[model samples]
Target chain A: MSIVRLLIGGATPRALALLAALLAFLVAAPAFLGPYALSVAILILYFAFVGQAWNIMMGFAGQLSLGHALYAGLGGYIAAGLFFHYGIGPWVGAFVAVAVAVLAGCIVGYLGFRFSLAGVYFALLTIAFSEFTRIAFDHWTWAGGSGGLFLKVQGGVTDILNLRGGATLFYYAILILAVGAFVLCRLLLESRLGRYWLAIREDAEAAQAVGVPVFRCKMIAIAISAALTALAGVWNAFYYNNLFPETAFAMGRSIEITLAPIIGGLGTLFGPIVGAVVLTGMGELFTDLTEHLKISGLKQIFYGLALLVIVIWRPAGVWPWLAKRLGVEERGR
Target chain B: MSGARLEIEALGKRFRGLRAVHDVSFAVPAGAIHALIGPNGAGKTTIFNMIAGVFPPDAGAVRLDGRPISGLRPDLVCAAGVGRTFQIVKPFKGLSVLENVTVGALHRHADLETARERAGAILDALELGDRRHQLAEALTLPDRKRLEVARALATEPTLLLLDEVMAGLRPTEVDRMVTFLRDLNARTGITVLLIEHVMRAVMALAAHVVVVSSGEKIAEGTPAEIARHQAVLDVYLGDAAGDAA
Candidate 1:
């Protein structure tokens, strides 16, 4: 029963219809929107996908990470490097990126779990690793180093197969990634592994007493999260056609990826999606406001204010409040 | 039904130059109710921790079914059919009662569907069926304690370790718990080892008893025999007698 429910997204009939309608609108969005609006939609979906990737680790497994850029940066470099140097397509490079990301995740997870580093300390460890990688990449000469790596963009009609397509192709790609991430997260939440993660998250000692292999479960969460995030990184690289260690691996990038889920809701399926929409929409609004007023830093201020309001008034996050208002009781809580 | 299943051989633990437990040895026979009673800070819980593999013992061994399990991790020990509850209840506060038990059941049943079915049955058996959908944080203290036991039981343990499960309960609730545990033991054929401070519940439930004081065992016998043991009386019950007088 749960299998069928999770497969269909565990929504009521009305919610199912609402979701289908929303997805259909998003799928056909490019036809109606201008280039600028389409770009914003793509940005929203990109953040949503990456945010869901981070959610698996911190939201489900209760492992807070502040340096998710490690995976994203590594993924971008691997895919771009293969395409730029070895003439490999991102189609195959994506797999390599995922593999490398999972491997890095294992190493970090092993070190952190072995040393019993957790919570803020674990978050710090992730940041330290990402920063270290960024510094190393900055000095290295291969793949353009500090100069940045750029992919060959053949100017023509949209090339959907090669990912050299226009904004429309990128938009659809991000939409697919976001929806895929949501379904994957929902399925994971109903799985046995998900139960073990919640148990460990709630109380590690009690979880161990109940026969949960805490370390293994945590490692699995980290590996899966890193792999998924790497996919998003590959997408980002292909869409932008360039990668700079400073921008790609920045601490701000990690914080930006996590902000959506934190505002939407931490442990819910649609939290990242909802959070991404709100954050991206407000960001666009603030950018427009700043442009008209000739003011800078309004975007940052808006983000800070949104985060403060969510943390204070809606600690469980906007998704749960929205659910309550909509009279929808979420399952698998 | 009669042979010893868990044997603690001179188990000892020390923390920062303080001996929390030392030279503690006892055996819980299969299908028997064994109680470990001690005064506050008497190392009863320390002994429980050692037996449950929460941490490695400084010295000596813990054996389950004549096999050493002292240094095994808590999850491995539980996998070997030894389940335990914390003195302070640790339910998954964000989870429903069924979800909490399902986590425990997942230890034995890898499939979530099977685990959920078994967890449901366990909750029903524990009289928590009506509250299956409620968040664990919403449960009252007594119900939470029952949920704790229900969780451990869902693991299908051969030997169940309960820590201070009767604390802070009303008289009627305590009685209900005693009856519940007795019925559980009779139905499940699980060996029971409990660390408890409530003497009335201990006396009514435990057939065998070990008394401890200040990190050492003071007496070991049947509950009634230890109730009258001179060392136990002087260290524990004698104080109660003096307070009453």
Candidate 2:
């Protein structure tokens, strides 16, 4: 019975099956798709990865951060600058970017926790810090100030040394990252830290009264969340081959990254992925419809309406309703 | 049985201009039931908060097993073997009854399995085994009070500070709670410092009683002595001393 249950009930087997299906689709995708379609797929996965990383802090740890794009921007700039200036490979640069982002996350976490700032106050602090970083980066001229930095266009499929080889390479690289982010979130959801995080989220004072080191646990959550988001930034820079302070550090970008998890199911393991797919798919449809009809501002109006409807009708997000329908156990309730 | 002793010297707490606890000094001996009784605003809960490291005292020292613990955080104080339950009962509403207890167990026990085992044992002992899987918010008032005790017990504290565990209990429920407290102190040898307004329960359970009125220690004695004392009678029955007769 145990063996039978394990075969049917374990997340591992289900995840493996899903991976196999996705791999099959990816391998056959290029044969049947054009450049635009492939680009859309890459964008979906990129947002999915970022959403998952953000979910770790906001959803799981219950620390609402509104300026997550700051870490992403920092990671992207660090990796892009390292590659452009020192001719360093993105593989090594990604790790350094992640480390720096983790350090920044720790600082933010310390400030919030040490001051006992929580809920909306913590979110405001993150926004304030991100805005500060954005202003500082905008003034720094080494990375082209407010103009931007663009990588040189390469002419081959195998220019792996330059980290701007081919569209197909970028696609596969981001796919791996998306999968890695999902696995990391899954691991966190099932671990001791996850339980501690849930306890702290539920009642921080009570958790401390029970001897849970509230500050240290929160800092750990922030660090892990920042590191993962930074790694996604590395891929973002490499895939686009262009970095700009405004585009990378915009408050809109942070909101876009968070919207996926909010619409998917905040705090649930699969909420970010589900949310990313829905939003990205809808965005693609909206863009195509607007272009064909020559309509102005339709996409923005649609997104705003959708967000309002979701918040009003199903505030828990799409994944929770889907989980109930499909009989799947939800995590971090 | 080998729990640490709690000592408070010159403990004082002020809320703005008013002194809540003034020069309060007491010692909770290991493995004994001590009661702090007072009127509505006698600073009983304030003393508990200061002792449990909820907030630093204005001018005092709290020593746990002879180690100075006045400036430590609540979690640090808990780790050092001091556990307390709030008078209002602050349970993690989203977590299950067992999970709420498990959070306390996680302090001393690192692994989930061991913590679960300990939590299960505590739940059974607290007569909450039937509602182990229920959300804490779903529990009734009496159950919530039981959960508070269970949560504190799971922390494995040497000294337990209970604030009005029998505050709203009926006569039978109060008797049961008194029996449970007595059994816990005798069996686990956990030193109990209870702040209660229920005169009957306090007189029946507490070996030593300390009374406070208007943030001052008005009387300290055994149950019979306190019940017969003129000061306690005046404080409870008011200035009309002839009304008691």
Candidate 3:
């Protein structure tokens, strides 16, 4: 009966009960956790939200974007830029960020779809755009150029209203965003457009022959994905209270955002969320191990090994394998 | 019934130096079951592609119901009352059988539930109702072909273009498909333009037959007339046509 469950590929009663338990655990988590643990939890949720956004493009729509950081970087700059120059809060600038990101998506989608750039070419184009933005932002004086944009923290107390606060507010913000994204994606995957996307992903020619507006549907996918990614970017900028084009729009950042969904599962609704939790959770564990041993870069090595193992053992992702083990069947997903 | 539901005028297509289809013209009257027959690389599928707007012909025009459909995108062609099944049976393998059909149903019925219900009916009509929830990839070759036809039928097209719908079927399955195609045309009054190599199906169902060879329409007539055509014997059947006679 819950809206979230209804939105999530029409979750069965058992799935609903499980989801309720998970939600309860997440809600009560902050109460018992210390600041460090809370931050880790927030980071996990943050990645989960972004992962969901990326999943819309690659997972559902089957457009492999390797430079998703383009959206996030652009969104961050817009929000941060507005706040720095016009004294507009990120809350208000979020709209501008979305608009800009959608516009960028349209341009990229137009060029890519128009020229029929697909597969590795599409991925390269996305990376090229992100790289271009990185270079442009590096030279732009209004956003502190290469020096990076830093938001001045007032006093020391948490500023919940302005989003310049402690990690707790961000945790809740990201939690809400992740929930919203999940519901939205669920609704999308069940809709007519989603069906068209699935068809297009399977065979574009056959889809077009069946009256699906293939190019338009793909553009919509890209635009929606960019908008969602931009929202996450805006949040990332405000939460970190700083922006550097190098780190913000880095290709590595895009890869990081996409790694979880790929490792977890490609098209399933909960793949990204589950993947983020596992990935971030393992990352933290690896960092702890490295710290105890006084070694650096162990986390990176662990990530590579994890990815290799997942690719070898569970190519369809952890979610599909886990779902099979759990006897959960979602139709047409 | 009425005149031609689909008209191709001087249709020609080229892939670099190779002429896939050249000045190929044909017409399928409304409510008629038409067959386009040719040997391998004779441009039968190429003509279908042109009519279905897979790509614009280098020269010529396609009109459906007196409306210009040439140079239109494939989806636009479909929207203009054309539905097609691929020669290779390109089913949405990841989706369930019902979902695969539902994608076409969504063209006319925008509501997902209505489209789903319509897709269900189409699957039932195609004798695939029991496997509606099964993934398309899990189906046998015959079932995959059936799913392809089912998906095309769900679009409610005035003209249905089937590219070798009976290519790999067993003899019994081929007979069943022939019966189904005839029944479909009789029931829905939908025009059928099919490319087929099955001589029995061609003789049994096609109201008219057009033969192409080397990217050109070599002959067009009733099935019996095509059977006697000298060029069809020379180019298509070779010694087989002589043996039949």
Candidate 4:
């Protein structure tokens, strides 16, 4: 264990150097790339951030949430609506969104925990809530209902006042959010709560027998997960300058968020990031291939196949494989 | 004698139509090693379960230090200074031996460092220091029993309810356990309520003995007194009473 720690401590400098170089590369990429490519990069970072947020609940705490996108959608809509109607900045609106998400998360967590609902049942509850919220939002015309709300396009490129600007702004903004989410998850996974969560995940009955407040720990996980996911929602709203219930709160969107962590490695710190990169890269590659071949629904088919293959071949996910190569200790039961 | 007392009054637990335990009553006085001896299906474990709050009795009450604790959650019962080990030891199979005890320590000490320190001390005292890093599932049956006791002890319970801890141990192992229990009770003054089938060990260690037959307390007295009781001889000794000459 000391040797593992020493290796990790020694690698910190090199890791930081690599991260710095990657940041530099990303910062410079938009300067030379076309508008389309930059948009894709921004989307990749956005998914990675949301994936990390979802990872906190599902990966770390082992709480499967099929409706996590509800928090993200609600967060984005609340922030975007508040800003559009009351002249609130996205910065202030983001906190409100997070607060709302936490409250909603608590409600969901309480209902689930109170009834001792877990495994597939908990996942089903999340989906049910998200679907209910989506339908309600679809009928609410203030945010344009099913037609969706589109932000007024600013005439100039440097329209920072309205948070509507060029591709560079979105890219940098999402990069920061993704990095922040990664750091937040890292800190949480190393803290006392992390071990408690792991214990609960491994054996909740035994954990409670030993004095871990199982419900409270699970609630905390949900709140943190919701708060981080809401921040991603705020980013989604600002970057796109649009809100639509079907697209934002869809089950497909939740699955997309869950897939990153599932594919990369469910519980590891870097699993979500790796998963996000692979899913996003594959998505982009598939889109290009489909466009050239004029194949309909090819991307979804490919993604489904990929998921099935990964589950069959490497059920533990990509992180274990990467950990072996990188000499990091594998963490999950 | 640390003033630990466990009292069960008219405790009745019925499963569907069958009464597993009926009107069973017993008191384990402070600082005494009390043994509950019964034949198989005599409701010894069911009585322990009720005291440990595994299930609330259909009728009657359980008290710890004169405070009613019946129907309370298991963790709350533990917090009220009543710690229990299961008849079938349920250690956290995935966790290491040290981590298993750490969970108990965490109940009283929230801080991981303090919990770890307390757990380490317990492992040392239990002679489990060498196997602290091994997963609990890999431990031998005797070690698992020790770990169960250690885990319960880490909770710092004033009253320790040990259920058939020596069930599968060999004679020598049982002797070593008897010595450990004697030392623990003598030094720590943690009141012990042990349910056991080993008549020899129970007779040697228990200061007070309660004999149960078919969920009813047929006898309660000192070890020697119970040993001489004809009812105990009839219920427990059975045909072996002739060999006891």
Candidate number achieving the greatest lDDT relative to the actual structure: 1
Q: Give lDDT tens digits, candidate 3, residues B1-245.
A: 22238888999889999988888888888899989998999998888888888888999999998999989999998888888898988989888999999999999988788899999998998899999989999999999999999998888889988899898999999999999988888777889988999888888889899999999999999999998788889886577766766
* Alpha carbon lDDT at B137, candidate 3: 92
lDDT of 4 by residue, B52-125 (tens): 77788899999998999999867778888887888888887767888888878878886666887899999988
Candidate 2 segments whose C-alpha is farther than 4 A from its true place: A1-34, A159-162, A331-333, B242-245
**Candidate-wise lDDT, in order:** 0.89, 0.84, 0.88, 0.83
lDDT of 3 at A50: 88
Candidate 2 vs candidate 4: the TM-score winner is: 2
Residue pairs in collision within model 1: none
Single out the weakest 10-residue window by summed lDDT for candidate 3 chain B. Answer: B1-10
Residue-wise lDDT of candidate 1 within A26-124, one digit each (tens)? 999999999999999999999999999999998999999998999999998899889888888888999999999999888889988878898999999
TM-score of chain A of each: 0.96, 0.92, 0.96, 0.91
lDDT of 1 at A262: 91
Q: Candidate 1: which stretches are off by over 4 Å?
A: A1-5, B1-4, B237-245
- Tens digit of lDDT per residue, candidate 2, span B1-245? 45678888988889998989988888878887889997899899988888887899998899988999887888998888888998998888877898889878877877765787899999998889999988899999988999999998889999998999998888899998899889888888888899998888898889888888888788888888888888888888887984756
Q: For candidate 3, give the lDDT of residue B54.
A: 83
DockQ, structure candidate 3? 0.85
lDDT of 4 by residue, A75-110 (tens): 999989888888787888988999999999999999
Q: Poorest 10 consecutive residues of model 3 chain A by lDDT?
A: A1-10
- Give the better candidate number (1 or 2) by lDDT: 1
- Between which residue pairs do clashes occur in model 3? none
Which digits, one per residue and each the tens of the lDDT, describe model 3 over residues A139-159? 999988889999877656776
